[model samples]
Target: MKKILLVCSAGMSTSMLVKKMQETAVKEGKDYEIEALALSEAESKIDDVNVILLGPQVRFQKPQVEKVAGGRVPVDVIDMQQYGMMDGESVLKHAESLME
Candidate 1:
């Protein structure tokens, strides 16, 4: 299963997104291990993830996350509009594209 990590200021907001993504993944017959974590927890979890998606609220931390990830995993920010709308399919697609 592909591992996707969603990071935000406190990990709380992304939890809802995680659920939506999982629902979409199931509906689309995609296999994935998705989870959310606070920015503070990213370093410890980076090694185990295939892709890192930053919540828009934490987009400023992208460079720091990338640095910590050391180019080992792809890091990108979720589109603001999609994120705000909680469009799981689009976010999942974004993750899928990054995995490519």
Candidate 2:
């Protein structure tokens, strides 16, 4: 199973996207572990994740997160439009592609 982590300013804001992503995964028969966390809590959670996706609001922190990730995981910023629209399928596909 792949562990995909989404990070935003407050963590709370990504819950809906997480839900949508989870639903998409289930429908596609993917057993991925999807989750979201506040930027403040991301570092601690990064260790176990296979990929880390940043919310548009927190995209600027990608460098910092990558530093913490230290090449152990792939980190990327979600597309602003996709995030704004809460398009979970796109984001989930993006995450999977990164893992691949």
Candidate 3:
């Protein structure tokens, strides 16, 4: 299974997105382990995740996250519009694209 981690300022806001992404993954028959974490927790969690997605609010921290990720996993920022709309399908698609 693919392990997808979503990071935000406090990990609270992205929890909703995680839920939606989980639902979308199930509906699409995609086997993925989706979770949310605070940016501060990302460094420790990076080794275990297949991809790291940052919430728009934390987009500025991409460089820090990527450094922790160390190119072992793909890192991408969630689009502000899609995130605000809670568009799980698009977000999931974006993640999937990154994995590719």
Candidate 4:
């Protein structure tokens, strides 16, 4: 199974995205673990994840998250338009590409 981590300012809104990602993963029969957390908690969550996705509001923190990720995982910022529109398929595709 693959692990994907999402980081945001407070983690609340991003949890919704986590749900969508989960649903997409289930529909595709993909084996994966996805979780969302506040930026403050990101350091502890980085170790085992394969990818790190940042919420638009937290885009400024990408460098920090990447530093902690230390090349072990690919880190990216989720598309704001997709995120605001709640486009699960697009987000899922983005996540899948990271694994590839």
For every candidate in turn, the CA RMSD to the true structure comes to 0.6, 0.6, 0.6, 0.8
Better of 1 and 2 by lDDT: 1
lDDT of 4 by residue, 1-100 (tens): 8998988999999999999989998999989898999999989978889899999999999988888888989999999999998777798899889989
Which number leads on lDDT? 1
lDDT of 3 by residue, 34-99 (tens): 999998887898889889999999999999888878899999999999999998889999999999
Residue-wise C-alpha lDDT for candidate 2, range 1-100, written one tens digit per residue? 8899999999987999999999999999999999999999989988899999999999889999999999999999999998989999999999999999
Residue 91 alpha-carbon offset, candidate 3, angstroms: 0.5
Per-model lDDT: 0.95, 0.94, 0.93, 0.90
Question: By the lDDT metric, which is better: model 2 or model 4?
Answer: 2
The residue-by-residue lDDT of candidate 1 on 1-100, one tens digit each, is 8999999999999999999999999999999999999999888999999999999999999999999999999999999999999999999999999999
Cα deviation of 90, candidate 4, in Å: 0.9
**Clashing residue pairs in candidate 3 (N, C-alpha, C atoms within 3 angstroms):** none
TM-scores, one per candidate: 0.98, 0.97, 0.97, 0.96
Off by over 4 Å in 2: none
TM-score (C-alpha) between model 2 and the true structure: 0.97
